[model samples]
Target: MTPRTPAPGSVTEATCTRCQILKPAAAFYANPLTRKGLHSRCIECMKDVGALRREVPKTTAAEATCNVCGWLKPSSEFHVNRRRFNGLTNRCRACAQDYYQAKRRGIIEYQRQHRWEDARVRMASDARRRDRKHGRESDIKAKDIVIPRACPVTGKPIYHGYGVRMAWSPCLERIDKSKGFVKGNWRVVSWEAVEASGWQLTRT
Candidate 1:
Protein backbone atom coordinates (compact mmCIF):
# COMPACT_ATOMS: atom_id res chain seq x y z
CA MET A 1 0.00 0.00 0.00
CA THR A 2 1.24 3.55 -0.72
CA PRO A 3 1.87 5.80 2.35
CA ARG A 4 -0.61 8.67 2.84
CA THR A 5 0.81 12.20 2.38
CA PRO A 6 -0.03 14.91 4.90
CA ALA A 7 -1.75 18.06 3.62
CA PRO A 8 0.31 21.23 3.18
CA GLY A 9 1.04 22.98 6.49
CA SER A 10 -0.01 19.79 8.33
CA VAL A 11 2.42 17.88 10.59
CA THR A 12 3.51 14.35 9.70
CA GLU A 13 4.91 12.09 12.48
CA ALA A 14 7.55 9.45 11.71
CA THR A 15 9.47 7.02 13.92
CA CYS A 16 13.32 6.92 13.78
CA THR A 17 14.34 3.26 13.31
CA ARG A 18 17.75 3.85 14.96
CA CYS A 19 16.51 5.77 18.03
CA GLN A 20 13.10 4.13 18.15
CA ILE A 21 11.46 7.55 18.85
CA LEU A 22 8.67 9.24 16.97
CA LYS A 23 9.21 12.87 15.83
CA PRO A 24 7.73 15.42 13.41
CA ALA A 25 8.96 15.77 9.81
CA ALA A 26 11.03 18.82 10.96
CA ALA A 27 13.20 16.48 13.10
CA PHE A 28 14.37 14.40 10.06
CA TYR A 29 16.03 15.13 6.72
CA ALA A 30 14.00 14.90 3.48
CA ASN A 31 14.71 11.63 1.67
CA PRO A 32 13.93 12.21 -2.03
CA LEU A 33 14.14 8.48 -2.91
CA THR A 34 11.79 7.26 -0.19
CA ARG A 35 8.15 7.97 -0.66
CA LYS A 36 7.84 8.05 3.12
CA GLY A 37 9.60 11.44 2.67
CA LEU A 38 11.39 11.64 6.09
CA HIS A 39 14.94 10.33 6.63
CA SER A 40 15.42 7.08 8.60
CA ARG A 41 18.13 8.76 10.78
CA CYS A 42 17.04 11.13 13.56
CA ILE A 43 18.36 14.50 14.83
CA GLU A 44 21.04 12.72 16.90
CA CYS A 45 22.54 11.10 13.77
CA MET A 46 22.60 14.46 11.98
CA LYS A 47 24.48 16.03 14.89
CA ASP A 48 27.12 13.24 14.73
CA VAL A 49 27.59 13.83 11.01
CA GLY A 50 28.13 17.59 11.64
CA ALA A 51 30.77 16.87 14.29
CA LEU A 52 32.66 14.50 11.90
CA ARG A 53 32.63 17.19 9.24
CA ARG A 54 34.28 19.66 11.63
CA GLU A 55 37.10 17.17 12.44
CA VAL A 56 37.94 16.53 8.77
CA PRO A 57 41.11 18.14 7.34
CA LYS A 58 40.45 21.11 4.99
CA THR A 59 44.00 22.16 3.92
CA THR A 60 45.07 22.11 0.26
CA ALA A 61 48.55 22.11 -1.34
CA ALA A 62 48.23 25.75 -2.43
CA GLU A 63 47.46 26.92 1.14
CA ALA A 64 50.99 26.25 2.50
CA THR A 65 53.41 29.17 1.91
CA CYS A 66 55.98 30.99 4.05
CA ASN A 67 55.36 34.71 4.23
CA VAL A 68 59.00 35.64 4.87
CA CYS A 69 60.90 33.26 2.58
CA GLY A 70 58.06 33.12 0.04
CA TRP A 71 58.80 29.40 -0.11
CA LEU A 72 56.03 26.92 -0.86
CA LYS A 73 56.19 24.17 1.74
CA PRO A 74 53.91 21.48 3.13
CA SER A 75 51.31 22.22 5.81
CA SER A 76 53.47 20.29 8.31
CA GLU A 77 56.23 22.91 8.07
CA PHE A 78 53.86 25.78 8.98
CA HIS A 79 52.49 26.57 12.40
CA VAL A 80 48.94 25.58 13.37
CA ASN A 81 46.03 28.01 13.87
CA ARG A 82 42.37 27.66 14.74
CA ARG A 83 41.13 30.94 13.26
CA ARG A 84 43.69 32.01 10.62
CA PHE A 85 46.68 30.66 8.67
CA ASN A 86 48.85 28.06 10.43
CA GLY A 87 52.26 26.37 10.22
CA LEU A 88 55.73 27.68 11.06
CA THR A 89 56.54 31.41 10.88
CA ASN A 90 56.83 32.89 7.34
CA ARG A 91 60.54 33.54 7.87
CA CYS A 92 62.49 30.57 9.16
CA ARG A 93 62.91 30.64 12.98
CA ALA A 94 66.72 30.95 12.64
CA CYS A 95 66.54 34.06 10.50
CA ALA A 96 64.11 35.67 12.92
CA GLN A 97 66.48 35.06 15.87
CA ASP A 98 69.48 36.49 14.00
CA TYR A 99 67.57 39.64 13.03
CA TYR A 100 66.58 40.28 16.65
CA GLN A 101 70.14 39.68 17.91
CA ALA A 102 71.64 42.13 15.44
CA LYS A 103 69.13 44.81 16.40
CA ARG A 104 69.94 44.29 20.10
CA ARG A 105 73.72 44.52 19.49
CA GLY A 106 73.32 47.79 17.59
CA ILE A 107 71.32 49.26 20.49
CA ILE A 108 73.97 48.12 23.03
CA GLU A 109 76.83 49.70 21.07
CA TYR A 110 75.01 53.02 20.73
CA GLN A 111 74.17 53.16 24.45
CA ARG A 112 77.72 52.25 25.47
CA GLN A 113 79.26 55.16 23.57
CA HIS A 114 76.68 57.87 24.40
CA ARG A 115 75.30 56.97 27.85
CA TRP A 116 78.29 57.41 30.22
CA GLU A 117 77.78 61.13 31.06
CA ASP A 118 74.00 60.65 31.25
CA ALA A 119 74.46 57.71 33.58
CA ARG A 120 76.74 59.71 35.91
CA VAL A 121 74.23 62.60 36.04
CA ARG A 122 71.40 60.17 36.73
CA MET A 123 73.37 58.53 39.55
CA ALA A 124 74.05 61.91 41.23
CA SER A 125 70.39 62.89 40.90
CA ASP A 126 69.28 59.57 42.36
CA ALA A 127 71.64 59.98 45.33
CA ARG A 128 70.26 63.46 46.03
CA ARG A 129 66.68 62.25 45.74
CA ARG A 130 67.36 59.34 48.09
CA ASP A 131 68.98 61.72 50.58
CA ARG A 132 65.98 64.07 50.41
CA LYS A 133 63.57 61.18 50.85
CA HIS A 134 65.45 60.00 53.93
CA GLY A 135 65.88 63.59 55.28
CA ARG A 136 68.93 65.81 55.91
CA GLU A 137 69.60 64.34 59.39
CA SER A 138 70.18 60.88 57.90
CA ASP A 139 72.62 62.29 55.39
CA ILE A 140 74.66 64.04 58.11
CA LYS A 141 74.74 60.83 60.20
CA ALA A 142 76.03 58.87 57.20
CA LYS A 143 78.76 61.43 56.54
CA ASP A 144 79.89 61.48 60.19
CA ILE A 145 79.89 57.71 60.59
CA VAL A 146 83.54 56.51 60.70
CA ILE A 147 84.49 53.05 59.53
CA PRO A 148 87.02 51.74 62.10
CA ARG A 149 89.54 49.90 60.01
CA ALA A 150 93.01 50.20 58.53
CA CYS A 151 93.95 48.41 55.35
CA PRO A 152 92.88 44.78 55.63
CA VAL A 153 96.17 43.67 54.06
CA THR A 154 98.45 46.07 55.94
CA GLY A 155 97.90 47.35 59.49
CA LYS A 156 98.02 51.13 58.79
CA PRO A 157 95.91 54.11 59.83
CA ILE A 158 92.87 54.85 57.63
CA TYR A 159 92.11 58.51 57.13
CA HIS A 160 88.70 60.13 56.61
CA GLY A 161 88.30 62.10 53.37
CA TYR A 162 85.47 64.22 51.92
CA GLY A 163 82.60 61.74 51.80
CA VAL A 164 85.22 58.98 51.52
CA ARG A 165 88.01 57.22 53.39
CA MET A 166 91.72 56.57 52.68
CA ALA A 167 94.36 54.18 54.01
CA TRP A 168 98.09 54.79 54.57
CA SER A 169 100.78 52.14 55.02
CA PRO A 170 104.44 51.64 54.25
CA CYS A 171 105.69 48.57 52.46
CA LEU A 172 108.29 47.03 54.87
CA GLU A 173 109.72 44.89 52.05
CA ARG A 174 110.33 47.96 49.87
CA ILE A 175 111.98 49.89 52.73
CA ASP A 176 114.29 46.98 53.54
CA LYS A 177 115.18 46.37 49.90
CA SER A 178 116.04 50.09 49.39
CA LYS A 179 118.59 49.80 52.26
CA GLY A 180 120.35 46.91 50.52
CA PHE A 181 118.88 44.33 52.91
CA VAL A 182 116.96 41.16 52.02
CA LYS A 183 113.27 41.19 52.98
CA GLY A 184 113.39 38.06 55.21
CA ASN A 185 116.88 38.87 56.66
CA TRP A 186 115.94 42.18 58.40
CA ARG A 187 116.96 42.59 62.09
CA VAL A 188 114.49 44.07 64.58
CA VAL A 189 115.89 46.91 66.78
CA SER A 190 114.29 49.48 69.08
CA TRP A 191 115.31 53.10 68.57
CA GLU A 192 115.54 54.97 71.92
CA ALA A 193 115.22 58.74 72.44
CA VAL A 194 118.99 59.07 72.63
CA GLU A 195 119.68 56.95 69.51
CA ALA A 196 118.55 58.13 66.09
CA SER A 197 116.94 55.53 63.83
CA GLY A 198 118.87 54.49 60.69
CA TRP A 199 118.43 57.26 58.09
CA GLN A 200 114.66 57.01 57.78
CA LEU A 201 112.91 58.34 54.72
CA THR A 202 109.31 59.35 55.44
CA ARG A 203 106.79 58.62 52.69
CA THR A 204 105.89 62.01 51.19
Candidate 2:
Protein backbone atom coordinates (compact mmCIF):
# COMPACT_ATOMS: atom_id res chain seq x y z
CA MET A 1 0.00 0.00 0.00
CA THR A 2 1.23 3.54 -0.86
CA PRO A 3 1.82 6.01 1.96
CA ARG A 4 -0.66 8.96 2.20
CA THR A 5 0.67 12.55 1.95
CA PRO A 6 0.00 14.97 4.82
CA ALA A 7 -3.24 16.96 4.31
CA PRO A 8 -2.91 20.78 3.69
CA GLY A 9 -4.33 21.83 7.11
CA SER A 10 -2.66 19.01 9.05
CA VAL A 11 0.81 19.40 10.68
CA THR A 12 3.66 16.85 10.35
CA GLU A 13 6.68 16.76 12.73
CA ALA A 14 10.24 16.68 11.25
CA THR A 15 13.60 16.56 13.09
CA CYS A 16 16.47 18.99 12.23
CA THR A 17 19.98 17.53 12.94
CA ARG A 18 21.54 21.07 13.02
CA CYS A 19 19.06 22.62 15.50
CA GLN A 20 18.47 19.29 17.26
CA ILE A 21 14.75 19.98 17.50
CA LEU A 22 11.58 18.28 16.30
CA LYS A 23 9.79 21.02 14.28
CA PRO A 24 6.76 21.20 11.98
CA ALA A 25 7.40 19.97 8.39
CA ALA A 26 6.85 23.59 7.18
CA ALA A 27 10.04 24.73 9.01
CA PHE A 28 12.19 22.37 6.83
CA TYR A 29 12.63 22.26 3.04
CA ALA A 30 10.89 19.74 0.78
CA ASN A 31 13.39 17.23 -0.63
CA PRO A 32 12.34 15.11 -3.64
CA LEU A 33 15.31 12.77 -3.11
CA THR A 34 14.07 11.69 0.38
CA ARG A 35 10.66 10.43 -0.77
CA LYS A 36 9.25 14.01 -0.81
CA GLY A 37 9.82 14.29 2.94
CA LEU A 38 11.13 17.42 4.76
CA HIS A 39 14.96 17.75 4.72
CA SER A 40 17.00 17.37 7.89
CA ARG A 41 18.13 21.05 7.56
CA CYS A 42 15.81 23.98 8.51
CA ILE A 43 14.90 27.13 6.57
CA GLU A 44 17.64 29.13 8.34
CA CYS A 45 20.30 26.72 6.97
CA MET A 46 18.96 27.20 3.44
CA LYS A 47 19.21 30.99 3.86
CA ASP A 48 22.90 30.65 4.91
CA VAL A 49 23.58 28.55 1.77
CA GLY A 50 21.93 31.23 -0.41
CA ALA A 51 24.10 33.95 1.18
CA LEU A 52 27.31 31.95 0.50
CA ARG A 53 26.26 31.43 -3.13
CA ARG A 54 25.88 35.24 -3.71
CA GLU A 55 29.13 36.34 -2.01
CA VAL A 56 32.09 37.54 -4.14
CA PRO A 57 35.84 37.48 -3.44
CA LYS A 58 37.02 40.90 -2.20
CA THR A 59 39.73 42.60 -4.28
CA THR A 60 42.89 43.79 -2.52
CA ALA A 61 44.94 47.03 -2.96
CA ALA A 62 47.48 45.18 -5.16
CA GLU A 63 44.74 44.53 -7.74
CA ALA A 64 43.60 48.23 -8.08
CA THR A 65 45.21 50.77 -10.47
CA CYS A 66 44.35 54.33 -11.53
CA ASN A 67 42.91 54.57 -15.02
CA VAL A 68 44.57 57.96 -15.62
CA CYS A 69 48.33 58.56 -14.97
CA GLY A 70 48.79 54.75 -15.03
CA TRP A 71 49.60 54.68 -11.32
CA LEU A 72 49.06 51.55 -9.26
CA LYS A 73 47.19 53.17 -6.41
CA PRO A 74 45.76 51.45 -3.30
CA SER A 75 42.15 50.20 -3.24
CA SER A 76 41.48 52.75 -0.47
CA GLU A 77 41.69 55.53 -3.09
CA PHE A 78 38.48 54.15 -4.64
CA HIS A 79 35.25 53.81 -2.70
CA VAL A 80 33.88 50.24 -2.55
CA ASN A 81 30.47 51.32 -1.16
CA ARG A 82 29.42 52.46 -4.68
CA ARG A 83 27.15 50.08 -6.62
CA ARG A 84 28.30 51.14 -10.13
CA PHE A 85 31.39 50.53 -12.29
CA ASN A 86 33.17 48.34 -9.71
CA GLY A 87 33.51 51.39 -7.39
CA LEU A 88 36.41 53.13 -9.14
CA THR A 89 37.07 56.70 -10.36
CA ASN A 90 37.88 57.09 -14.06
CA ARG A 91 40.65 59.67 -13.51
CA CYS A 92 43.12 60.24 -10.66
CA ARG A 93 43.11 63.46 -8.58
CA ALA A 94 45.96 65.24 -10.43
CA CYS A 95 44.62 64.45 -13.90
CA ALA A 96 41.10 65.54 -12.94
CA GLN A 97 42.35 68.96 -11.69
CA ASP A 98 44.32 69.58 -14.90
CA TYR A 99 41.28 68.74 -17.06
CA TYR A 100 39.03 71.09 -15.05
CA GLN A 101 41.50 74.04 -15.17
CA ALA A 102 41.92 73.78 -18.94
CA LYS A 103 38.15 73.62 -19.47
CA ARG A 104 37.53 76.64 -17.19
CA ARG A 105 40.13 78.88 -18.90
CA GLY A 106 38.76 78.00 -22.35
CA ILE A 107 35.21 78.88 -21.25
CA ILE A 108 36.24 82.17 -19.61
CA GLU A 109 38.14 83.43 -22.69
CA TYR A 110 35.35 82.42 -25.06
CA GLN A 111 32.67 84.20 -22.98
CA ARG A 112 34.83 87.35 -22.58
CA GLN A 113 35.25 87.77 -26.38
CA HIS A 114 32.03 86.43 -27.89
CA ARG A 115 29.05 86.75 -25.51
CA TRP A 116 29.34 90.19 -23.81
CA GLU A 117 26.64 92.07 -25.76
CA ASP A 118 24.19 89.16 -25.95
CA ALA A 119 24.69 88.41 -22.24
CA ARG A 120 24.03 92.04 -21.25
CA VAL A 121 20.77 92.13 -23.26
CA ARG A 122 19.67 88.76 -21.89
CA MET A 123 20.37 89.86 -18.29
CA ALA A 124 18.30 93.08 -18.72
CA SER A 125 15.39 91.16 -20.30
CA ASP A 126 15.50 88.52 -17.55
CA ALA A 127 15.37 91.19 -14.80
CA ARG A 128 12.33 92.82 -16.40
CA ARG A 129 10.63 89.46 -16.94
CA ARG A 130 11.19 88.46 -13.28
CA ASP A 131 9.78 91.79 -12.08
CA ARG A 132 6.63 91.35 -14.18
CA LYS A 133 6.16 87.72 -13.20
CA HIS A 134 6.41 88.42 -9.47
CA GLY A 135 4.59 91.81 -9.53
CA ARG A 136 7.64 93.52 -7.96
CA GLU A 137 8.99 97.05 -8.70
CA SER A 138 12.06 97.04 -10.99
CA ASP A 139 15.16 98.60 -9.42
CA ILE A 140 16.44 100.18 -12.66
CA LYS A 141 16.84 103.91 -11.98
CA ALA A 142 18.24 106.80 -14.07
CA LYS A 143 21.11 108.93 -12.76
CA ASP A 144 20.74 112.68 -13.66
CA ILE A 145 23.67 113.89 -11.49
CA VAL A 146 25.91 116.42 -13.21
CA ILE A 147 29.47 115.47 -14.13
CA PRO A 148 32.16 117.56 -12.44
CA ARG A 149 32.92 120.47 -14.86
CA ALA A 150 36.54 120.95 -13.80
CA CYS A 151 39.24 119.11 -11.85
CA PRO A 152 38.42 120.15 -8.27
CA VAL A 153 42.05 119.95 -7.00
CA THR A 154 44.26 120.25 -10.13
CA GLY A 155 42.32 123.15 -11.68
CA LYS A 156 42.94 121.80 -15.19
CA PRO A 157 40.86 120.68 -18.19
CA ILE A 158 40.33 117.03 -17.28
CA TYR A 159 40.12 114.97 -20.49
CA HIS A 160 36.58 113.62 -20.79
CA GLY A 161 37.78 110.10 -21.59
CA TYR A 162 40.72 109.96 -19.15
CA GLY A 163 39.12 111.58 -16.08
CA VAL A 164 36.88 110.22 -13.30
CA ARG A 165 33.47 110.54 -15.06
CA MET A 166 34.79 108.89 -18.25
CA ALA A 167 37.07 106.27 -16.76
CA TRP A 168 36.09 103.97 -13.92
CA SER A 169 37.88 104.66 -10.60
CA PRO A 170 37.39 101.98 -7.97
CA CYS A 171 36.49 103.17 -4.46
CA LEU A 172 39.51 104.31 -2.41
CA GLU A 173 40.60 102.71 0.89
CA ARG A 174 40.13 105.85 2.99
CA ILE A 175 37.35 108.37 2.50
CA ASP A 176 37.85 112.07 3.37
CA LYS A 177 34.43 112.62 4.90
CA SER A 178 35.47 116.01 6.37
CA LYS A 179 36.74 117.13 2.93
CA GLY A 180 33.39 116.31 1.26
CA PHE A 181 34.44 113.00 -0.38
CA VAL A 182 31.02 111.61 0.57
CA LYS A 183 27.88 110.83 -1.41
CA GLY A 184 27.00 113.28 -4.26
CA ASN A 185 30.64 114.43 -4.24
CA TRP A 186 32.93 113.57 -7.12
CA ARG A 187 35.84 115.25 -9.00
CA VAL A 188 37.86 114.51 -12.12
CA VAL A 189 41.64 114.36 -11.76
CA SER A 190 44.68 113.15 -13.69
CA TRP A 191 46.56 109.98 -12.70
CA GLU A 192 49.52 112.11 -11.55
CA ALA A 193 47.16 114.30 -9.51
CA VAL A 194 45.64 111.21 -7.91
CA GLU A 195 49.12 109.85 -7.05
CA ALA A 196 50.28 113.25 -5.75
CA SER A 197 47.18 113.36 -3.52
CA GLY A 198 48.56 110.26 -1.73
CA TRP A 199 45.28 108.28 -2.03
CA GLN A 200 45.81 104.55 -1.59
CA LEU A 201 43.78 102.09 -3.64
CA THR A 202 41.92 99.33 -1.77
CA ARG A 203 43.36 95.83 -2.22
CA THR A 204 39.84 94.43 -2.64
Candidate 3:
Protein backbone atom coordinates (compact mmCIF):
# COMPACT_ATOMS: atom_id res chain seq x y z
CA MET A 1 0.00 0.00 0.00
CA THR A 2 1.19 3.45 -0.74
CA PRO A 3 1.73 5.94 2.14
CA ARG A 4 -0.78 8.79 2.41
CA THR A 5 0.72 12.07 1.38
CA PRO A 6 0.90 14.69 4.15
CA ALA A 7 -1.09 17.91 3.61
CA PRO A 8 0.78 20.91 2.22
CA GLY A 9 3.40 22.18 4.78
CA SER A 10 2.02 19.83 7.48
CA VAL A 11 4.84 17.18 7.49
CA THR A 12 7.98 19.06 8.60
CA GLU A 13 8.22 17.15 11.90
CA ALA A 14 6.33 14.27 13.53
CA THR A 15 5.86 13.13 17.15
CA CYS A 16 7.34 9.70 17.99
CA THR A 17 4.58 7.64 19.66
CA ARG A 18 7.13 5.81 21.84
CA CYS A 19 9.46 8.59 23.07
CA GLN A 20 6.68 11.21 22.82
CA ILE A 21 9.26 13.65 21.41
CA LEU A 22 8.83 15.72 18.25
CA LYS A 23 11.67 14.90 15.86
CA PRO A 24 12.46 15.43 12.21
CA ALA A 25 10.80 12.87 9.93
CA ALA A 26 14.34 11.64 9.18
CA ALA A 27 14.51 10.11 12.69
CA PHE A 28 12.00 7.40 11.76
CA TYR A 29 12.27 4.46 9.40
CA ALA A 30 10.29 4.72 6.21
CA ASN A 31 6.96 2.89 6.31
CA PRO A 32 4.96 2.92 3.10
CA LEU A 33 1.67 2.10 4.87
CA THR A 34 1.75 4.75 7.58
CA ARG A 35 -0.05 8.09 7.13
CA LYS A 36 3.23 10.07 7.67
CA GLY A 37 5.37 7.70 5.57
CA LEU A 38 7.34 6.59 8.70
CA HIS A 39 7.05 4.31 11.66
CA SER A 40 5.47 5.58 14.91
CA ARG A 41 8.63 4.90 16.93
CA CYS A 42 11.90 6.72 16.25
CA ILE A 43 14.97 4.87 14.96
CA GLU A 44 16.67 4.71 18.39
CA CYS A 45 13.63 3.32 20.22
CA MET A 46 13.05 0.79 17.46
CA LYS A 47 16.63 -0.35 17.66
CA ASP A 48 16.34 -0.90 21.42
CA VAL A 49 13.14 -2.91 20.98
CA GLY A 50 14.76 -5.03 18.28
CA ALA A 51 17.77 -5.74 20.46
CA LEU A 52 15.50 -6.83 23.32
CA ARG A 53 13.70 -9.31 21.09
CA ARG A 54 16.92 -10.99 20.02
CA GLU A 55 18.74 -10.93 23.34
CA VAL A 56 19.14 -14.07 25.49
CA PRO A 57 18.94 -13.13 29.16
CA LYS A 58 20.37 -16.42 30.42
CA THR A 59 23.54 -16.11 28.35
CA THR A 60 24.22 -12.60 29.61
CA ALA A 61 25.87 -13.74 32.90
CA ALA A 62 24.42 -10.89 34.90
CA GLU A 63 22.61 -10.63 38.21
CA ALA A 64 19.06 -11.99 38.44
CA THR A 65 16.26 -12.08 41.03
CA CYS A 66 15.52 -15.38 42.68
CA ASN A 67 11.85 -16.24 42.65
CA VAL A 68 12.02 -18.27 45.86
CA CYS A 69 14.18 -16.14 48.15
CA GLY A 70 13.33 -12.84 46.45
CA TRP A 71 17.02 -11.90 46.41
CA LEU A 72 19.08 -10.47 43.58
CA LYS A 73 22.08 -12.70 43.08
CA PRO A 74 24.70 -13.45 40.44
CA SER A 75 23.51 -15.57 37.54
CA SER A 76 25.87 -18.37 38.47
CA GLU A 77 23.94 -18.90 41.71
CA PHE A 78 20.98 -20.31 39.78
CA HIS A 79 20.71 -23.77 38.34
CA VAL A 80 20.06 -24.17 34.63
CA ASN A 81 16.44 -24.72 33.63
CA ARG A 82 15.73 -25.42 30.00
CA ARG A 83 12.23 -23.91 30.20
CA ARG A 84 13.34 -20.42 31.30
CA PHE A 85 14.38 -17.81 28.77
CA ASN A 86 17.56 -17.13 30.79
CA GLY A 87 18.19 -20.88 31.08
CA LEU A 88 18.39 -20.55 34.85
CA THR A 89 16.19 -21.70 37.69
CA ASN A 90 13.91 -19.13 39.25
CA ARG A 91 15.43 -19.76 42.72
CA CYS A 92 19.00 -19.04 43.75
CA ARG A 93 21.41 -21.87 44.59
CA ALA A 94 20.77 -21.84 48.33
CA CYS A 95 17.02 -21.60 47.93
CA ALA A 96 17.01 -24.24 45.26
CA GLN A 97 18.96 -26.62 47.50
CA ASP A 98 16.52 -26.13 50.32
CA TYR A 99 13.55 -26.61 48.05
CA TYR A 100 15.03 -29.77 46.58
CA GLN A 101 15.86 -31.30 49.94
CA ALA A 102 12.47 -30.36 51.36
CA LYS A 103 10.65 -31.84 48.41
CA ARG A 104 12.57 -35.08 48.45
CA ARG A 105 12.97 -35.82 52.17
CA GLY A 106 10.78 -33.19 53.89
CA ILE A 107 13.48 -32.63 56.53
CA ILE A 108 15.37 -29.67 55.10
CA GLU A 109 14.25 -27.21 57.79
CA TYR A 110 14.78 -29.71 60.57
CA GLN A 111 18.20 -30.69 59.28
CA ARG A 112 19.25 -27.05 58.91
CA GLN A 113 18.79 -26.55 62.64
CA HIS A 114 21.50 -29.11 63.43
CA ARG A 115 23.83 -27.88 60.73
CA TRP A 116 22.69 -30.77 58.54
CA GLU A 117 23.78 -33.42 61.02
CA ASP A 118 20.27 -34.82 60.96
CA ALA A 119 20.61 -35.20 57.20
CA ARG A 120 23.56 -37.57 57.62
CA VAL A 121 21.69 -39.49 60.28
CA ARG A 122 18.64 -39.78 58.04
CA MET A 123 20.77 -40.90 55.09
CA ALA A 124 22.05 -43.86 57.06
CA SER A 125 18.53 -44.63 58.27
CA ASP A 126 17.15 -44.40 54.73
CA ALA A 127 19.60 -47.10 53.71
CA ARG A 128 18.09 -49.35 56.30
CA ARG A 129 14.63 -48.64 54.94
CA ARG A 130 15.78 -49.48 51.43
CA ASP A 131 17.28 -52.73 52.65
CA ARG A 132 14.00 -53.64 54.31
CA LYS A 133 12.11 -52.81 51.13
CA HIS A 134 14.38 -55.07 49.12
CA GLY A 135 13.77 -57.91 51.66
CA ARG A 136 17.38 -57.72 52.87
CA GLU A 137 18.00 -58.06 56.58
CA SER A 138 18.32 -54.71 58.38
CA ASP A 139 18.46 -54.38 62.14
CA ILE A 140 19.19 -50.64 62.10
CA LYS A 141 16.79 -48.27 63.86
CA ALA A 142 16.50 -44.69 62.66
CA LYS A 143 16.54 -43.41 66.27
CA ASP A 144 19.71 -45.34 67.05
CA ILE A 145 21.95 -43.13 64.84
CA VAL A 146 23.84 -40.47 66.78
CA ILE A 147 25.56 -37.34 65.53
CA PRO A 148 28.24 -35.88 67.81
CA ARG A 149 28.49 -32.10 67.98
CA ALA A 150 32.26 -32.32 67.39
CA CYS A 151 34.52 -34.83 65.72
CA PRO A 152 35.94 -37.39 68.14
CA VAL A 153 39.33 -37.33 66.42
CA THR A 154 40.03 -33.68 65.52
CA GLY A 155 37.72 -32.11 68.10
CA LYS A 156 36.40 -29.73 65.45
CA PRO A 157 32.74 -28.96 64.97
CA ILE A 158 30.90 -31.52 62.88
CA TYR A 159 28.72 -29.41 60.67
CA HIS A 160 27.89 -31.56 57.69
CA GLY A 161 29.39 -34.19 55.40
CA TYR A 162 30.10 -32.12 52.33
CA GLY A 163 33.04 -31.37 50.05
CA VAL A 164 36.57 -32.86 50.00
CA ARG A 165 38.28 -29.96 51.72
CA MET A 166 40.64 -30.50 54.69
CA ALA A 167 37.93 -29.31 57.10
CA TRP A 168 35.18 -31.32 55.49
CA SER A 169 32.26 -32.19 57.80
CA PRO A 170 31.81 -35.41 59.71
CA CYS A 171 30.06 -38.44 58.18
CA LEU A 172 28.36 -41.67 59.19
CA GLU A 173 30.52 -44.73 58.62
CA ARG A 174 29.11 -48.20 58.57
CA ILE A 175 31.63 -50.78 59.72
CA ASP A 176 29.81 -53.35 57.60
CA LYS A 177 26.56 -53.01 55.67
CA SER A 178 26.38 -56.78 55.26
CA LYS A 179 25.93 -57.02 59.02
CA GLY A 180 23.01 -54.57 58.86
CA PHE A 181 22.24 -51.75 61.36
CA VAL A 182 23.29 -53.72 64.43
CA LYS A 183 24.37 -51.74 67.53
CA GLY A 184 28.16 -52.15 67.12
CA ASN A 185 28.30 -51.89 63.33
CA TRP A 186 28.21 -48.15 62.78
CA ARG A 187 29.76 -44.95 64.09
CA VAL A 188 29.85 -41.24 63.34
CA VAL A 189 33.37 -40.19 62.32
CA SER A 190 35.03 -37.16 60.80
CA TRP A 191 35.48 -37.09 57.05
CA GLU A 192 39.21 -36.66 57.58
CA ALA A 193 39.52 -40.13 59.10
CA VAL A 194 37.51 -41.73 56.33
CA GLU A 195 39.71 -39.99 53.75
CA ALA A 196 42.95 -40.78 55.54
CA SER A 197 42.05 -44.46 55.85
CA GLY A 198 41.25 -44.49 52.10
CA TRP A 199 37.90 -46.04 52.89
CA GLN A 200 34.78 -45.06 51.00
CA LEU A 201 32.07 -45.27 53.69
CA THR A 202 28.80 -46.52 52.29
CA ARG A 203 25.63 -44.76 53.43
CA THR A 204 24.11 -47.78 55.10
Give lDDT per model, in order. 0.46, 0.50, 0.69
- lDDT value for model 2: 0.50
Q: What lDDT tens digits, residue by residue, belong to model 3 across residues 1-204?
A: 233345577566789888899988767777867777788888888889888777665464477799877889987898776556777778899997887787867566555656454565675667577667656666765566677888776677776635443555656566776765557877777777677656644642
What TM-scores do the predictions have? 0.25, 0.28, 0.34
How displaced is residue 106 in candidate 2, in Å? 1.7
* The candidate that achieves the highest lDDT relative to the unseen native structure: 3
lDDT of 2 by residue, 1-204 (tens): 122345686548777777778877777776656754667677877678777666554543333566667887766565453333344566656667788899999987886544433433443454345445656444421231222435555555433322232322211221332222223333334444566656443111
Candidate 2 deviant stretches above 4 angstroms: 1-63, 76-81, 116-204
Question: Model 1 residue 85 lDDT?
Answer: 35
State model 1's lDDT.
0.46
The 10-residue segment of model 1 with minimum total lDDT is 165-174
By descending lDDT, how would the candidates be arranged?
3, 2, 1
Rank list by TM-score: 3, 2, 1
- Please write out the lDDT profile of model 1 over residues 20-111, one tens digit for every residue: 88987777776767767767877777678667656634553335566667777665565555434342356444446677899999998787
Cα distance off (Å), candidate 2, residue 195 = 21
Query: Which segments of model 3 are wrong by more than 4 Å?
Result: 1-121, 129-136, 161-167, 176-178, 201-204
What TM-score does candidate 3 reach?
0.34
